[model samples]
Target: MTKTLALIAAAVLALPLAATAQSSTDAKPAAKAAAKPAAKPAPKKKPQVTRRAAKAVEEVTPIDTSTDVTLNEADLAVAGRVHTGKIQCELGADVTVTADESKPGYFTVSTKGAKYRMHPVESRTGAIRLEDPRAGAMWLQLGNKSMLMNQKQGLRLADDCQAPAQVAMSAELKLNPPKSLFEGADAPTSGPVKK
Candidate 1:
């Protein structure tokens, strides 16, 4: 009877240990499943555009490929009033650039007391461009107006302001002239004398 009782007790103790071992083994698989990384979703493919839709879109936007534009001397002449806002200078002043395109291929630019003679140079655009190498200045003519830029000083004067009245060269001369040489009657005479 004692032998049978001892065998039963041993089996009872082994039952809890076996249950724990089985539970731990089962939990290992669950833990591994939770730790596994999820698979990535497949990349989405772009929807194909119908041929009719592409043709309709192309018809809506037309491309211009004409290259017949030309710029001539007349286009570059600074004839009309061209003015700009206050120029950023040392004294912070406004400047007026007057161009006389009377002479082809050559033009005169006047601002304040300074005058620059410019000549046309090759430009890649339709705008007429003139340059004064001496002063390092450039004049870009756009339609009826022009802009003056100083390359050396890195200054730009746009043709956005209202130009003042055109100053006549003759009027300026009339206003200010040199002192009269023949002030008195003792004027020097130069001529061929007949004996």
Candidate 2:
């Protein structure tokens, strides 16, 4: 009888421990679920900034307009040659160069969505060069063609640009190509010799 009583006491003591272990195991998952709710989807991101946006910002940015850049006679002469009005380029691109009446030797060069304030910059190669230092843009005008380049980006914006004079010059060049210096002078005629 005593052996049976001790057995019953052992079972009673073990019952509580087993119940607590089961409860703890059940509570862990519930606590975890409550502590960490389902992660909400990440919020959508804003659109990426664009080059056009940056350019727009640049337009609004204040810059000093008082600094007068004086040009000499040569620069003025070059400016006069700079073809104003719409000039066409290859790939159907066009640029409009308008001289500033208020500011001689100054021009506003525009294309598509961009505009630059340019001034004649003397060129050692005899090409007409207009530059907008702030914008890092340069316009090079040759006798038969012209090109606009972004010095900062190291890329050509427009090429083969032709004004009326340039168009005429190009046609003339096609009709009468320049003589090559390498070829020898024409041989004297067999029967005729200069006295």
Candidate 3:
């Protein structure tokens, strides 16, 4: 019985060594096959730019300041408000919105002389939206004549008020207004003045 058990243990130990020798012989052929250099990939071709396409690129000009830029009301209504709206918020605060004529994508929202510049952003739904990222506020245009203003602190306002056209500043006043700080004062002297 002892002799038989010893033979079984020796056979079990020898089995792993035989399998390892067989795997090593099998791996040599695979390693020799992998040692050969792989075939090189074909070089890529560059796209040709034709002269007409180059001329098409050169013919593109920047926005010309010489031409007058006008804002269409219908497009403005869909994207942003063309005119300003005076809103009374639920927090009992009065807010004023001034649409930028030169840049139709921006608006100025003012409250008690404090102004905030807001940019138009794509809304989740079909509503027109203006967002003030600094203040974490959003203004949604509900209809052609009404707007809903929302703040992060849960303050909301429904505004339908519109200011009269006369309240708008004239083009002359808006373009070249007098300087506020040094209207009457001369330029500061460079050094101490002589007696």
Candidate topping lDDT: 2
Residue runs of model 2 more than 4 Å from their true location after superposition: 1-68, 184-195
lDDT of 2 at 116: 93
lDDT of 1 by residue, 52-102 (tens): 222222222222223232336454443222333333222333344444456
Give model 2's TM-score versus the native structure. Answer: 0.59
Indicate whether candidate 1 or candidate 2 has the larger lDDT. Answer: 2
What TM-score would you give candidate 1 relative to the actual structure?
Answer: 0.31
Candidate 3 local lDDT, residue 168: 36
Candidate 1 deviation (Cα RMSD): 41.7
Q: lDDT of model 3 at residue 170? A: 27
Instruction: Rank the models by lDDT, top first.
Output: 2, 3, 1
User: After superposing candidate 3, which stretches have Cα over 4 Å from the reference?
Assistant: 1-77, 80-93, 144-150, 157-195
lDDT of 2 at 178: 61
| lDDT for predicted candidate 1 compared with the true structure | 0.46
Displacement of residue 101 (Cα, Å) in model 2 is 0.7
lDDT of each: 0.46, 0.73, 0.50
* TM-score of every candidate relative to the true structure: 0.31, 0.59, 0.34
What's the C-alpha lDDT at position 59 in model 3? 22
Q: Which ten residues in a row have the lowest lDDT in candidate 2?
A: 47-56
